[model samples]
Target: MNPDDFSRVRSLWTHCGLPSRPNGRDSEQHIRRELSDNTASFLVAVDPDETLIGTVFATHDGRKGWINRLAVDPRWRRRGVAQALVAVAEAELRRNGIEIIGCLIEDGNDASEQLFVTLGYSRHDDIHYFTKRDRPDI
Candidate 1:
């Protein structure tokens, strides 16, 4: 999404229990920079009234594509909003020539896991996700 959508996007993230911050990678400035860089896209789904109902961050490292920070408004959950978001994001990644798309679901998010599985993603319990961030907040 554009920088103009940052505030509502951040609110949606928080409402959906996704990570966002005043000090981390999700800042409007950082999002603006990433948008300008064009390596990633912060996509949002809005309703007829233009109220944002979902969001997903799609990015790729010239190989596998990644879907991250997916969030759907609680009011919209169990509807098709999340599936639509993922579909659009996957289409965008495919347009960029990405063949394999993946996402990480933290422990205890059974709903997300189920959603991905329903969307045709295989469940892999064989690998671990490792991250080395300079700070925890980021």
Candidate 2:
């Protein structure tokens, strides 16, 4: 999406009652670089007037592809924008020779969980999501 679409994306998230973390330093340039490079890709859904209604980000880590921070504008929900984004990301990953795409969805987020399943993703058992920060010593 174009730089002008950030306002729409921001508004969409706000309308969804979610506070997005700031893009963290030189956001526009970073996004442009990502879209131009092999490292990352993002998709956005825009209305007839080019106002954004949804967005998702994907990254290639030299081994597998990962999708994260997917969101759809609440006002524009259930219109297939999110689905399209996922499709595009998967296609790109496949093109890059990525054998599989993995997404980490919070356990209670039914919609996301279902979307991945519907898209042919299966959740692997025996692997639970755990986090560890840089700090050590309890």
Candidate 3:
């Protein structure tokens, strides 16, 4: 995603009442730079007129693959944009030699969890996910 892509994504973000804009100019620039440099691969869904509608971001450590961002525009939901983006992202990540692909989603995001499960990812029962920063008292 580039600076120019914000307007399209912003509309989706605002319309969905989600905080879509990056926190700061520097932060925004950093993300775009990373995307352009392929430190991560960022994909955007655009309309026939070229208006951005949705986006996803993924990273690979040449080992484990992680997806950090995935959002679909309200106007484009139910049309398979999110699924297509995931498909492309997974293929690209796998091509990079990563085997396991995982996305960290809020426990309450049933939709996203469902999406991942339907794509053949099963929640690990053998391991627990712990976070250092998200502790409730933090």
Candidate 4:
């Protein structure tokens, strides 16, 4: 995504129920940084009127490809926008030599789970995910 698309993308994120963190990751700086790192992995889909309808962000750390922030406008859900975004991102990752691609879907989010499953992503029940906030203790 380009700098010009930041505000629309941010608004879309909010509309799709994705939280915005205090860190720079949720800022324009972060979007610029990620796009600079890998432009092809950051994509946005728009309709004929040029309104942002969908978005997906993917990145690779030279070992594994990670997909995140897959959001589709509520008015456009179940219309193949999310699937198309994933398909393009996965293809880009594979073309860049990434062997493993993974996405994290929150528990109870059955729609996302089904989308991934329908796209052939196998659930790895053998592994658990842990996280640490980058910010310091209050």
Q: Using TM-score as the measure, what is the rank order of every candidate, best first?
A: 1, 4, 3, 2
- Better model by TM-score: candidate 1 vs candidate 4: 1
The lDDT of model 3 is 0.73
Candidate 4 lDDT: 0.85
TM-score of each: 0.94, 0.78, 0.78, 0.91
Per residue, candidate 1 scores C-alpha lDDT tens digits across 1-138 of 878898999888888888656687887777888888756977999989999989999988889999988999999889888898899889989999999999988898899999999999998899988889998878
* Candidate 2 lDDT by residue in tens digits, 1-138: 656666666676677654344454225555666667766777787789877777777788879999866788777778888888888888878888888789887667898888889888998877988867443321
lDDT of 2: 0.74
Best by TM-score: 1
Report the number of clashing residue pairs per model: 1, 0, 0, 0
TM-score, structure 2 vs. true: 0.78
Which candidate number has the best lDDT? 1
Across residues 1-138, which tens digit of lDDT does each residue of candidate 4 receive?
A: 677988898899999997555354666676677777753478899999999998898888889998888999999998999999999999889989998999988888999999999999999888899867666420
Give the lDDT of residue 98 in candidate 4: 94
Q: Which ten residues in a row have the lowest lDDT in candidate 3?
A: 18-27
In model 4, the worst 10-residue window by lDDT is 19-28
